[model samples]
Target: MNMLHTQLLQLKPDDIIVEPSVTPLLAGRYRTKRRRQTLHTHKQFDDWVTVSGVQKRRQRSCKVCALLRGDRNKSYHTTFFCEDCSHGEAKCFLYPKARREYNGKRVVLQRPGKVGRRKKTRRELLQDGGAADDEEDD
Candidate 1:
């Protein structure tokens, strides 16, 4: 409780706090036991309302959920992406099985080389118009 107060105060002016009211829209799977859950129950702490409001910033948009669900029908600006994603490469989100599509995409430059999607062969190992091992056998 006390730590939350300090964290909220330290937030950037542009940052938004994802409370219970806003968490559903941000990430529906967030655990209810999280500290932000306490913010939803405000009647008991009437005095702290003003203090909390000043410190906590509301989320302007749910970047995490948007990237995971990819429900944006209209053209929307992207803000987040997996570090290993590339412009033309296909990839699933960190929890691909849980979602139908990736929440976001990224250029290869932004991603780490080691985190790329599984590949059958390295680009350097590929031979152009040459006899491969299987071809020689045939």
Candidate 2:
């Protein structure tokens, strides 16, 4: 039930309807899986309402910690929260079914190649002639 709620809160109305398609033969009537969206979540408050999105972390503070123990300095920081829900509340939530969905698009961002480089592989270092570009007429 908790997982269901977290997903609902993360909803954003896209310009195009991706969930369902009516392309006759090509499109599916229903969404097979949730697409990994890159959300730029930022930490609003220190402990109560923190956010994390598109950031890679090997170990995140467990979500269950908040459920077992109240949010009072338990340090079970959540990734994202609905602005409507957090407003005017004493604390964001006590035992929220905290779940994390990482943005897979991060793999492209973390590629070893330098930024602004082309998608294709670099040209061959050695040309047909044996003399490399660096060794030209110096």
Candidate 3:
């Protein structure tokens, strides 16, 4: 699957493996060695790869429009806003996923609490002067 493995499979039995400094014994084929590796690949090469995941959007700003606008551009709402406040200046805050700007401020989207709020403990209630009457009276 990797580049190196594909190259090794392409070699023929009689093919010579060249070394710059010195020759290696493994380079030459032996009489008993009938099998040789040949080059083959099932998948095409790619210049770019993508991963899937959830991300925050409101915390970062767009980078491409930043370069274009220089000091005039302001980033907010997970995007860049031009000096004129027009839609043209606004761009995708996320990088690599979209074709807009390659560089920019990152606006992370705010995430709400996934769990319920914690309740006060007995110790906290006692400290606040609400001790149990049963123990105190005894």
Candidate 4:
């Protein structure tokens, strides 16, 4: 737990990327454990909610969910915000058996977040003085 905290604190905001999930609305903002079932929990101590997936899953800062909340009309075990994902255990149950839909829509390891989420580099941070230290705390 301490090491996770240290690593978490060492992370920079630019290290994380925010994106919309294809299955944008599946579960709620928070999840709990019961009967040995897997569920999403608040991973970040600050709980910024970069991303989250259902049990037998996966996340980004959560503009995807934020964007979909008002539009969804139905949901399933992994429905687009179905909100009754009790059928989930360890295996995936994204509705209609479209397993491929559960995958992340985009990933760019060379960069963080969106294509241009961060325009500054470590050298640039250093140029900004204490700003770099503050960034490390995110």
- Measured by TM-score, the strongest candidate is 2
Write the candidate numbers in order of decreasing lDDT: 2, 3, 4, 1
Question: Whose lDDT is higher: candidate 1's or candidate 2's?
Answer: 2
* Candidate 4 lDDT by residue in tens digits, 1-138: 999999999999999999986765546545544575554332222112234443333222242333222233223323322223424442222333222211244433322233225578988878887877779999
Residues forming the 10-long window of minimal summed lDDT in candidate 3 = 39-48
Please provide TM-scores, in order, for all candidate models, with all chains considered together.
0.17, 0.18, 0.16, 0.17
Q: Higher lDDT: candidate 3 or 4?
A: 3
Q: What root-mean-square deviation over C-alphas does model 2 reach?
A: 22.3
lDDT of each model, Cα atoms only? Answer: 0.38, 0.43, 0.43, 0.42
Give the clashing residue pairs of candidate 1, or none: 17-57, 67-103, 68-103, 83-111
Clashes of 1: 4
Error of 3 at 48 (Å): 21
Q: Write the per-residue lDDT of candidate 3 for residues 1-138, one digit (tens) a residue.
A: 688898889878779776688755664456366655532221211223343654432344445434333344464323222232233534334222333322244334433233335788988877766456656877
Determine which window of 10 residues in candidate 1 has minimal summed lDDT. 39-48
RMSD of 3: 20.9
Residue-by-residue lDDT tens digits, candidate 2, 23-110: 6554575647676664423334343322485544233343344433433445554443434344565334322443332221223223
Query: What does the lDDT come to for candidate 2?
Result: 0.43
